[model samples]
Target: MIYKAEKFGEKYTTRWDNIDVDEILSSERLLGNYKKCLMDQGPCTPDGKELKKNLPDALKNDCSKCSEKQKINMHKVIDFFKDNKTEWWAELQKKYDPEGIYLKNHIANNRHGDKNDDKRDDDKKKEERDEMEKNDNKENSR
Candidate 1:
């Protein structure tokens, strides 16, 4: 069966029956083993050279047109994993694990933030927090 999870306006989909139980179990175990590594990671550095990688032409066409906050958030997420690769892998394992995962309310909540500005504000705060943490890491490393 196809299962979907939504979070922060993004949708994640998986097939329950088609996946391997052994793989899931192994991923969970690995994640548990690397929790500490994930927590200690730092932010990624800025790269403005323009990427023609990993994305389709349609999506990459106007990459530079993305908002400053969007760019920063993307970089921060990348940096976080790079700094804590093991932990990040573990967290991803947990996220993908079938038993503990909860489905996100994608249908009920729209991504546009048209229903309320609260979601926008919350996203902004999260971005700010990520940026602040990145800056703090840079300061500490100096």
Candidate 2:
């Protein structure tokens, strides 16, 4: 799981700023441990726990609290998963973005280059509208 640095008071601690992201991504063992930790399938290191605690807020707010360096690192992690570890990326999205809200933003931002993404989003919106119309019609009949 990519840790989107969260603000502690004014900014997230810079203690992790110098972390070698490439080193971790290259090591399957290290990355797997993080995946397990984030998925609640294994014990968490302190930093992993902190990251889990912050993840929901970061996702909801588009990492608004993240520093520029943290945002850069987050994007690097996201791209790595998308390009090299697509299945794992899907798992992460299923867990964190179950409603597809964040994924829509990613597609809108061209983070994922799938041309059909917009059509899927449009279909979902139409389905939602149809459901709402049905509910309104039922209410009016009653």
Worst 10 residues of 2 by lDDT: 1-10
Off by over 4 Å in 1: 1-62, 86-142
Per-residue lDDT over 90-131 for candidate 1, one digit per residue giving the tens place of the 0 to 100 score: 554354432422212211232332333465578889999999
- lDDT tens digits, residues 57-98, model 2? 767776667677766677667777866888988988899888
What TM-score does candidate 2 reach? Answer: 0.68
**Per-model TM values vs. the true structure:** 0.21, 0.68
Q: Which stretches of candidate 2 lie over 4 Å from their true place?
A: 1-10, 107-142
Clashes of 2: 0
Q: What lDDT does each candidate get?
A: 0.36, 0.74
